[model samples]
Target: IYHVNNWYGVGVGSVVFYNDAIDANTDRSLYRKDHVYTTADKIRAGVALNNEFKFGLITAMVDWGVYLYNPARHYYDNPEHPIYGLGRRPLFYKNDGAGSDEAFHYIRFGMKTRIWDNLYFSASAKTHLHICEYVEFGLGYQIPFLKKENRKHGEKIFHHRKNWWQE
Candidate 1:
């Protein structure tokens, strides 16, 4: 039995843009100012299981994720008078505050088998309900870093599992 959890937050500062100046006498003369902002959040939960079988190994896992995004909010500013120019004031803006909501799901299935004392092969299939989907396979050989005669069998496998730290 296994359990995993994760969370993330992202935000972008407001963006501003100014349009080129236009002749004050022309009816088409218009000054425009624009601003935009965006933000997002995500959470995930998952469980995994592994078991040894007579012919090989079997592993299965599933994860559910919730993602919320603001995508974008925009503001447009117009000048009260064409000659006065469009400043930061007189801007029309709208933001949903909480924005939009979205959900995602994922599943993974894999197996590994030892063909020989030092040789092994593995394969996995994975799918993301709303993102990416793919399948992958790999082969590997276990070479003892320390003298095999000096290490216990269980200790060797434990060392492999502890190879690196994941964030």
Candidate 2:
């Protein structure tokens, strides 16, 4: 995920934009369709609100994203269209090139906790509208030296502060 805001704090509003796509997966039995009645391969544009909740050393997050372009919903324009086959079913078209849909709202909420100062664990769940989509869990490791040489500089700063207080 790409973060537009540089600040990371509680009650701070972060605005972000995302473009998501569903790839064709034959193993998953998911396909991209281009027909009168088809599924949308793309959500086009997404806007989300990201908020952080802190609990001691652990941090939790809640995010809601609204998809602005859903091509799934269609209305019947010609029920007797030639391409509809023998049944003469209705011919559906794209709702809009880019438009908002109520059903495309997505939500994600999760927590991050430090397992060993630099090591961490994270868990999150994602849903489409109100339906459960998937849940994810991950393990991460961070080296203090990698974060702007925290190991060396951090020690010197602490040492200076300690000596300054004694003096």
Error of 1 at 13 (Å): 32
- Across residues 45-75, which tens digit of lDDT does each residue of candidate 1 receive? 3332232322213223232322122111112
TM accuracy, model 2: 0.43
List the global CA lDDT of all models: 0.33, 0.47
Model 2: colliding residue pairs? none
**What shift in Å separates residue 104 of candidate 1 from its native position after superposition?**
7.4
- Give Cα distance to truth, residue 70, candidate 2, Å: 3.7
Model 2 spans with C-alpha error above 4 angstroms: 1-45, 72-102, 116-119, 140-167
Whole-model lDDT, candidate 1?
0.33
Q: Estimate each model's TM-score.
A: 0.31, 0.43
Best by lDDT: 2
Q: Tell me, what's the RMSD of every candidate?
A: 16.0, 10.5
